[model samples]
Target: MRVAFALSLLAALLSGCASHSNPSPDGAWINQTAIDAAAEGGNLRQALLAHGPNLEWNIDTKGGKAIASNGFELSEGKIVSAADGKLRIDFYGNSFEDLTLKGDALVQTATDSGPEQRFKAPKEAAPAGAQPGTSFERGLYSAYLGGKWSIVQGEGQGGVVEFQPDGSVSGLPGNDRYALCLAGDCAAMSGEYDSMWLEKNEQGNPWIFVRSGNQLEIFQAVNNAKADEMPDLRPGASQWVLQKN
Candidate 1:
């Protein structure tokens, strides 16, 4: 039974990692808002490792009515079930409670008193480093941090951040601010800090992310993680992940 349980969990975690019916962009809730938020802390691996599936959508729907259309917006006391899995989460106004905790999906429904949400045991869970200092695994995860990133969020004239393997990150979409880094450590980064990542929901994709702080933002996150996507930027600007080299 113990072995069976472990197998079940593994299956659950790998659910959508492989080939599967992908979620449409419009249908995905972990869109721009999430990416922007995560960028503030800007630790995709750690952020995801500390995952609870933060979502973005309007609830009151009053001024922004579709009124409860997405049924995503919630008041301080509201609870919600996840569309991604079987987990129930309680809200505390600012953020969801019971986050990152191992569990099942939460169910949300209207009741006489108010809406109620419940969490089901999670199927399979995301894998994690057994210890805090697993150099090999951590290095593998951070490899993508190497490269230049443009701000793809702000509509009019947003900002962009470039993460270089040389231990630096920078860009100027519309600001005079700048930063230099030698590692993924957020605390050590120079300049004003504000950025995050938006995980990919579809298959065969690396992930979509953005960095937003103050008045800067990126809309859709994309990449050229594959070799076929790399190429020189200028005569020698270096290849990118998505665009064919």
Candidate 2:
């Protein structure tokens, strides 16, 4: 009778262990809530609502690799454990935290004090012909526009200006007045300002032009935009050309 009781206790322990086993986080996850938050925050350059549902996080726990799209850029990083024992992905020197698995969802936080963002695995595969990083590729023009640029041509030929990722500019001529016109009618505004608009050049190169008052400044990439590298910019001699500094 005692031997039978011992055998039963062993079985109970084995069952409990099996029940508490950690779930695998080896798949794709989409975070619609985070995308909605970005849109609500007046991020005009963020992904459109229709495309937001396709942005995803593809994680490979065993391979210690991960790729994520932030509506504007695709970042690939390594899966690592945080100092506080949370799972995180280190992307281009930035740390994305709290990849904790809770039930059928994956929860994350952009920063230590940021709100929890939940992600779920999609029931069906992405629509046909959609690349894994398609959602992020749209923002490559904006991404390549970031950083300091020296005005090599046009009116502000010897001055320096900085273009932020969020579409804000500093160090331009005048009172440094400029508004972000990523979309909509930017040219009608009657102010001496640097307003940006997107278009394609005759050579089929992606061009981002800035309208500073009556003068229109054009910028083209010195090299192709790459997911892993930042590209430089050059403009025509007639307009303003900025070289990345």
Candidate 3:
């Protein structure tokens, strides 16, 4: 009886799947018109939407402005050009292509990020003026970086450490507690012990740098690690989270 019941359940599941297996039109495929727009009107968003996937663009029309949207994440973007019938867009740190619009359709081809995905560009509304990384933004970033901070999290056994704008440093990204004593108005780090956290990483070269005003590059970064160790310590990209010191 149990065997019979199992067979019946499998039959029912298969029947249901068969019912929903009908084919439908695939509008997501790229086309020629989208490519034409990228070549003419600089319609990147439209071209990608129409010719590419079902992704909406988070367009910006200002210098150093950031926009957010579902399906795709964008940062470090600026207005390349915008006018009566012209549109151009680009993103910093990431790759994108230049598109031109003409009438209802667009022509888009990959300008960056490899061989590129070329197809028909869709129609999208023009972006408004608002850029990222302004003077006010930089000030806010500096304020966020000011005062003491602890390495709340990172790879390895590296624990928490504090920062003083006085120039001294403590705690490694994933290692010992680095310290730079300060007297009066001066400070400097002595170095890390038993840890390659603070050093230039002569061996593996673990590195850290600011990608933008609000964006910080945090990665494992090992110049040389064994095949097994590599998967565990590769330089995967991640942004830094700000904590009130």
Highest-lDDT candidate:
2
Worst 10 residues of 3 by lDDT: 181-190
| Model 1 Cα shift for residue 33 (angstroms) | 27
Q: Per-prediction TM-score, please?
A: 0.19, 0.38, 0.23
Quantify all predictions' global Cα lDDT against the true fold.
Answer: 0.30, 0.51, 0.34
Total colliding residue pairs, candidate 3: 35
Worst 10 residues of 2 by lDDT: 183-192
User: Per-residue lDDT tens digits of candidate 1, residues 41-93?
Assistant: 35443432233222222222122211111111223324354334222334444
Across residues 67-89, which tens digit of lDDT does each residue of candidate 2 receive? 77654456678887633224688
Task: Choose 1 or 2, whichever is better by TM-score.
Answer: 2
On TM-score, the stronger of 1 and 3 is 3
Q: After superposition, how far is residue 18 of candidate 1 from its true place, in Å?
A: 37
Residue-by-residue lDDT tens digits, candidate 3, 132-218: 212112221223333444343444222444443222344545332221111111111111101113332332333323223322234
